[model samples]
Target chain A: MTIDKKLNGTSLVIALEGRLDTMTSPQLEEELKTSLEGITDLTFDFEKLEYISSAGLRVLLYAQKVMNKQGSMKVIHASEPVLDVFDVTGFVDILTIE
Target chain B: MMTLTVKAHISNLSMVQDALGEWLDSIGCPMKTSLQLQMAVEELFVNVASYAYGEEEGDLTLSYEYEEELSLVRITFRDQGMPFNPAECLEQEEESTRLHVEDRGVGGLGILMVYKTADQVHYSYRDGWNILILEKKL
Candidate 1:
């Protein structure tokens, strides 16, 4: 999946427009690494995202951990399949979604 | 009607992944399936890269067999690392009762994704090695 970043004050909005899985998780990680310092709020947009693998969840967890220290993270527009992934992993409770 | 195989050191992940991605493209896998495969490939291979060698370099072999008529691609990740199958981990409670974020971790999400994403995942620890096979139906 392609990850694009936008910084709005304390919140960091990462819009993912592809698939998140094993191999690509590192790419997302790299993207976050360059941008994650001192950020309080995080937003993830799964608008064009099609799928997420366990590897992807691991990456999300890392991001959540980072945000937890400073702020909160929100995930928006999770598709049914992707939502199923969150449900299976039980990450729904940890994240904010609408 | 095609077969591709490559065995490389764990550090060359991108080169190998790009090759596999190219092969998948040639096989005409749908975009969504392609992304899932890519994620699986990265996760499985990275696990081997980090945990398998441990201050030593080990070999990783990847093979793709295409069944054009069936629209299926079977990717096998073979490694000489410690025998570990992320799929065998127990499922966490649907409602977890933990107070700390530390409880959140070392959880079974990675392996769960493997089982959830792949159509079939076969794991066998034989011949002194670990073999994880991932299948995606296009």
Candidate 2:
């Protein structure tokens, strides 16, 4: 997966492209860990993201836990199929989607 | 019925998906059903690759039979690794009510997705192999 980042003040927006499954989730975890410092708001753009597995959900859950203490987080532009997964996994209730 | 066998590893996930996609397309499976099938397959394949044999390398065979009469598809996964039953996890989650967000974990969600997406899921240990079968209606 390719992650493109845009830093606007204290808010950080990261857009992901490609599949976010077991093979690629670790890359996202590392990116979030290193880039989250001094950031209050985190937004994920999933318009280009085609797939996500449980491994990816784990990373997003961990990120949400961290962001809860810092500020806020939102996931936007999730495709119908990806959103279906979130809905089935009950992540739709836990995460803010816009 | 058709079958495909491959080494259990995270790196081979793409190949597995590609092959399954082609087979499903050839069968003229609906796009929605195909998506669910792919999701269920990925979850089981990743589970076996990550934990079934640990450091040891093994192969997993996936076989499926599509019954046009019933409009149902049955996919079976076989591996010669540890005997781990996924159905028990589903039972435990169902009995445990009032699970809070703090209790929401990512570990069991994959198996849960497999159970939810598939119409039926069964696990058995037979002839030194762990066999998991998932059935979905088209």
Candidate 3:
């Protein structure tokens, strides 16, 4: 998966492309670990993302937790399949989606 | 029925997905169903790779059969690793899903998803092989 980070002041928008599964979630996890130090707002742009498994959801949950204390995080432009995963996992209630 | 055997390693996830995706596409499986199947397969495969062998390398065999008449697909994962039944963890995971995000733990979510999305999930230990079968109606 390709993770593109755009930092405008304190807001960080990370766009993802391709599958986010067990093999790829760690990459995003590591990226967030290093990039989320001072960010006040975070956005996950899933416009180009193709798929997401539980591993991806885990990372999202982790990010949400981190941002909960620091700022706010939301997911935007998620595809139907990706949305379905969030819905099935009940993450729709926990994470902000747009 | 088609089968593909590969090492139970995290790096082989794409290889497994590609082969299965190609077969699903050739069979005209709907995009939504294909994605769900792929997710379930990843969850199960990763489970085996992470926990089944316990630091030892092993092989995971993925066998799938499509029933054109009923529009059903049955996929099986067989591994010669430790005996673990994914289905047994469903109850606990289900409870965790209902908890608040702060209280929820990350473990077992994958297996919980496989159980929720797949039409049927069956597990068996036969002749020292851990066999898991997932059936989905396309």
Instruction: Give the top-scoring candidate (TM-score).
Output: 3
- Against the correct fold, how does model 2 do in TM-score? 0.90
Q: Distance (Å) between predicted and true CA of A83, model 2?
A: 2.1
Fnat: each model in turn: 0.32, 0.41, 0.70
In the range A8-41, model 2's lDDT, one tens digit per residue, is: 9999999999888877899999999999988899
The digit string of per-residue lDDT tens for model 3 on B57-134 reads 999999989999999999999999999998678888878878898987767688888988999998999999999999
* Best-to-worst ranking by TM-score: 3, 2, 1
The C-alpha stretches of model 1 lying farther than 4 A from their native spots are A1-12, A16-41, A46-56, A65-71, A77-87, B1-10, B90-102, B106-108
What DockQ, between 0 and 1, does each candidate earn? 0.36, 0.47, 0.76
Ranking by DockQ: 3, 2, 1
Model 2 residue A62 distance off true place after TM-score fit, in angstroms: 1.2
Ranking by lDDT: 3, 2, 1
Candidate 1: tens digits of C-alpha lDDT, residues B1-138: 333444444557667667877888887777667766776676677677767767776677787888777777888877787888675463452323132454676444555556667899998888977877787789
Model 2's alpha-carbon lDDT is 0.87
Query: Candidate 3's error at B36, in angstroms?
Result: 0.7
The single-chain TM-score for chain B of candidate 2 is 0.90
**Worst lDDT 10-window in candidate 1 chain B:** B90-99
Flag clash pairs in model 3: none
Cα deviation of A11 in candidate 1 (Å)?
4.2
The parts of candidate 2 lying over 4 Å away from their true place are B92-99, B103-106
Q: Is model 1 an incorrect, acceptable, medium or high docking prediction?
A: acceptable
